[model samples]
Target: MLSATDIEVSLAGTPVLKGVSFHAQAGHVTAIVGPNGSGKTTLLRAMTGDLPYRGTVRLGEADIAAIPGWQLAAQRAVLPQASRIAFPFTVLEIVRLGMMASAEPPPERRASEALARVGLAGFEGRFYQELSGGEQQRAQLARVLTQVWDPVGPEGPRWLFLDEPVSSLDIAHQLDVMDLLGDYAARGGGVIAVMHDLNLTAMYADAVAMLAGGRTMAQGAPSVVLTDTTLSAAYGCDLRVNAAPDAPATYLLPHMARRAG
Candidate 1:
């Protein structure tokens, strides 16, 4: 499991995250959702040890701070919000970067397989700079997957820290990526994602943590955290949550009419 306790982060002289805490268990997908400036990405950075903060973050039984860089890379992978490649690198070359964490002889096969998993099969020779935005995002995911192929390693459970993973993708690709992550969690790997789409969260996430004003407003099952009252309050808008008989997941709709005209 990935657990954070009393996480606090400040940028320059301004506070960004305040006393935020949550746990994302293995075999489940945990989503962090909030409005703009709500510090969702900041909180994720803290958990990934990318930012210095006052808190204790643990992966399984080991503190994240104490883990060696290489070992951590083998156990967890991060898919950032955006990746900028200054040079022209082929998809295969980019995916191979993740293999740096491993001491194995050759990772070409695994890299190719990772690309296929992300629906980018036969894209090994394609230049990353030439691919569209959504394609680039998938390539990045493929890179991360190549790094940590097994969700549960011999040491313990592995994790995927994704920052707005599907932001660049269209509806079909969004479902593909979410379903991929869901399968990873189902295989006993932990997944913690910062997401903006509430409907997707409700459908794919096993748990949701709502953030507002740098604090954790609510954390629980999607059904509990995605209530009309909680979401409306967190987003500062009147939201109507609907449940349909045919659909198992809840849908969130903004009642624009309720806004001051």
Candidate 2:
């Protein structure tokens, strides 16, 4: 399990996250959701050690800060919101970079398998820079996937930390990526995603954390956290949530949202 307790993060002397606590079990998809500037990404950065923070982030029994960089790389992989390559590189070459952190890297076939997983099977020889934004996102995902190819390592379960992973993809690709994450979790890997789409969160996330004012407003099962009242209060907009009769999911109606008087 991964857990953060009393997390406080400040950027340039301005606090961004305050007293936020979170927990995610392995073999589950945990989502962090909030309105813009709500510190969703800030907290993720803190967890990933990209930002300094006052808190304890534990990966299982060991503090993440105590883990060595190389060992940590083998334990987890992160996919940023966007990636840019200055020099032109082929998709296969970019994906193969993921193997650099491994003490004993897997065979070259892993990269091809990852590309196939992300729906980019035959584009390995193409230049990464020429790919569309959505395609680029998928390629980056493939890289991250190749980094932690196995869900369970010799030490324990591996983890994937993704920031707005499907933000650049179309609707079909969004579902495809989310389903892929779910399958990863099903195979005993931990998945933590910073999500913007609440509908996708409802459909895919096993646990949800809603942030507001740099604090966690709610954390629990989606059905419990994604409520009309909690969402309206956090987003500061009048919004309605409805349950799908045919599916075990919830959806928010943007048309039902209205401005305050």
Candidate 3:
């Protein structure tokens, strides 16, 4: 499990996050839902120790600051939204880079397996930059999957920190990615995803933390956190929630408050 405590963040002389705290539990998905400036991404960066912030983060009860780089790399993996690469590399080569942190890691098998997991079995030799946006995102996911997936974990909790995992992905790919995340959690991994899509979050997340004004306004099960009241307050927009008759899931969409005409 991963826990963030009293986290405060500032970027370029401006405060972005204020004393944020939360936990990602094993066998569960904790989705961070918020508006554009909600500090969701900042909190994630802080949790992964990728950003400088004031707080204490613990991975499975061990102080994150105390853990060595190689050790932390093995225990947790972070998949940022996207990165700018100067040169294009083959997809296989890129995903295989994830294995650099492991000791005596399997090279081709790891890359191939991760690619296949992301539905990219034969995309090994394709140039990363040539792929479509969704495909490129999936490739990035393959790279992260190659790093984060630990099939056997009688050892320690595996944590995955993802920022907008489903952005720009088509509906099918979005569901596919969520399925993969659910599978990972079911197999004992923990996931914290910062997503802008609330409907998808309601469908896939076990718990949601709604951030507003750089703080968590609500954090609890989907049923409670995805309500119209919280949605309107956190997003500053009116929305409606409807439960499907066939499933236990709920869906959210804009209410489009009418102007006084």
Q: What TM-score would each prediction reach against the true structure?
A: 0.97, 0.97, 0.96
Q: What is the lDDT, from 0 to 100, of the residue 72 in candidate 2?
A: 95
Better of 2 and 3 by TM-score: 2
**lDDT top scorer:** 2
- Best-first order by TM-score: 2, 1, 3
Candidate order, lDDT descending: 2, 1, 3
- Indicate the residue-level lDDT of 21 in model 1: 94
Clashes of each: 0, 0, 0
User: In candidate 2, residue 111 scores what lDDT?
Assistant: 91
Taken over the whole model, the C-alpha lDDT of each candidate is: 0.93, 0.94, 0.86
Model 3: runs farther than 4 Å from truth?
151-154, 259-261
**Candidate 3 residue-wise lDDT, 1-261, digit = tens:** 678888999999888888888877888889999999989999998888889989899887788989998888887778888865568899988888888867667656888899998888899999998988888888888888877678335457687788999897999989999999988888888888999898899999998998998888888899999998999899887889988899778998688564432
Per-residue lDDT tens digits for candidate 1, residues 1-261, read 788999999999799999999899999999999999999999999988889999899888889999998889889999999999999999999999987887564446999999999999999999999999999999999999988888888888888999999999999999999999999999999999999999999999999999999999999999999998999999998998999889999888888687655
Candidate 2 local lDDT, 1-261, one digit each (tens): 999999999988889998999999999999999999999999999999999999899999999999999899999999999999999999999999998878886998989999999999999999999999999999999999988988999989999999999998999999999999999999999999999999999999999999999999999999999998999899987778898799878898754324433
